[model samples]
Target: MPPEPPDTDPGRLLAELIAIDSVNPDLVPGGGGEAAIAGFCGAWLAARGFEVHRLEKRPGRPSLVAVARGTGGGRSLILNGHLDTVSLADYDGDPLDPCIRDGRMYGRGAFDMKGGIAAMMVAAARATAHGPLRGDVILACVADEEHASSGTEEVLESFTADAAVVTEPSHLEVTLAHKGFAWFDVEIEGRAAHGSRPELGIDAIAKAGHFLVALEELAQRLAQGPAHPLLGTGTVHASVIRGGEEPSTYPAHCRITLERRTVPGESADSVERELTAVLDRLAATVPDFHYRLARGLHREPFAADPEALIVRTLARHAEQTLGHPPAVRAEAFWTDCALLDRAGIPCLLFGVDGAGAHAATEYVDLASLDRVTDILTATIADFCS
Candidate 1:
């Protein structure tokens, strides 16, 4: 049997977590990583008599794992969350400023994460305080989730869990699936020449312009393709572009950055092959207009079995605790849940209600935070039982 849930102070834990500046560099420059937050969590869990391990994938970027043992009768459940936020440089506001007003906690990572981390901690605290459970429970908090997914990847490589619940802000919905992401940089090369002598040399920018048109056409084709039942169709868009050195000279090279959303059955290699074929055909038309494709992040899509024992148990708990059956769906965004899913673990994404993540005035509803904690606590108990 699972231990009785203990009274946990989730609000104080959330405030303390929000106070730490664990914003990823892509979200904020010069902001510290997850070390401080991991340290705090380590101390908190240790003081609660839970077995805790602190793992650092990179210096100053720490990931923590805390475990509570139960009756050793069932598979383990992992509660995973990241302690990172997107860069807050343009906000002109303090990233660490966690202001609670009108039932919302305003902070850089309050919604995108931290809130989930707080709820996990509260659940873990209650589980520890109540006594032994029916099975093991692992609480994992990783770093660099806002930028690169290396943090969660490292965790998956090092540990295994039967099932995982990723605490990514999902408006308290049970997200059993999420789309993958593919990033690429396309570079067009050409000969530089004087602008006055246009006929003497090839213009890289002109070639790049043509290539952009082809890419746009491809994007449209992808958007119109058959959509995935849950995740929808893939999406392709050029996010950044740069080229040309001088106004009076034909540029030698141009580059465009693309972000592509991948649905189920879409692999990074397949996407590359398709794009390569398109560019190859274009190269045949434009003389000496060769291009190179550099791949960036290639996160895989993740889906959990709704019929899995842990998932079903959690869904029941959600309905019982939240007064409504949990909404099951797939997120359009990529998350660390994919990493665990790829490792053969059933993963689900769920968390607090909020808005404006990675934007100015990001905040998490305090009431939702409390509710999430309650849900987490009950879910863990049910899963372990």
Candidate 2:
């Protein structure tokens, strides 16, 4: 495909973006990182009079922080979207070949995010086309939103805005809250001995079974516990488990890796304590239930005030653009909204109507794409005015 002509039409721009392979290497080994895509965005924005600044502290993993500097004294706004996408291997068709049928555009990243990126780029360009606003309109086209949010993390180090809108796919709804997650590894220890000798050998895998049952009970307790208004109850599940070398010998070590999805009022510390309590009880009750617990990566859940300036502004624009008040919704998955919120920038998630994010088939409704672009353009103009 040829380079897209410099224009504000989001659908056209989305087709161009989907043609480039920006699969996250962290998610898929040997995957194309954000260098090519980031460069394309920087050039595209720079051509439209944005002051493009590319941040690539992690070598090839670059993130562009393009700014349309406002006249001054007005609240700045950020339009954020991820450039990196999930792997293309599992996609049903030619993931790089963007196709438009009916009203949906099918391709990898089209719905997962590149749709939002195109919309925000066009919105930013159109919003400031006539003249700059009183405050800056910053476009953060960041990398690694699929595996880790290191891209947004780096962007926050240098730039900030009064408010932000993470254009993660939301079916055009206003997403105010979503779940967070923490990973943990549990190692169940046991003495290795001959399998034929029942008394001499303590089966680590069998002992680990006890912990698995406890984990299920814990999940059930969480499900029956107090739930968040939007996100509902927190939950836990074992993701990966490995133990023993061969069937003939008593497996000395068993490892269980689990993930806990959290709602508001929960944190890594809380999850650690919960797991520790469970393990401690097992140690006390089960005769040889020795184990070690370690917490891994975690991100906090996000919730935005419905009345927040950004949320209200975007909602208003969406309502006007869609002919109905945008529905307020929440997600089970996490996004960069939490990072933006943690950075002290009031933010919320809103984006084009779409489906099949990271699935075998992915698509974004073309009409929804145009509507989101219009809504964002108006919101940017209003919020930065």
Give a tens-digit lDDT track for model 2, residues 1-385.
6533459779889999999999999988899999999999999999989999999999999999999999999989999999999989999999999999999999999998999999999999999999899999999999999988999999999999999999999999999999999999999998898888888888999999999999999999999999999999999999999999887899899999999999999999999999999999999999989999988899999998889989989998999989999999999999999999999999999998889998999999999998898899999999999
**How many clashes does the backbone of model 2 have?**
0
Model 1: C-alpha RMSD to truth? Answer: 2.7
lDDT of 1 at 29: 66
* Residue 156 lDDT (model 1): 77
Clashing pairs in 1: 26-87, 27-86, 27-87, 27-88, 28-87, 70-133
lDDT for each residue of candidate 1 in 264-381, tens digit (9 for 90 to 100):
8898988899889889999998787879999997888777888887678778888987899989889998888888877888878889998878787788998888888888888887
- Scored against the true structure, residue 158 in model 1 reaches a CA lDDT of 73
lDDT of 1: 0.83
Q: 337, model 1: CA deviation in Å?
A: 0.7
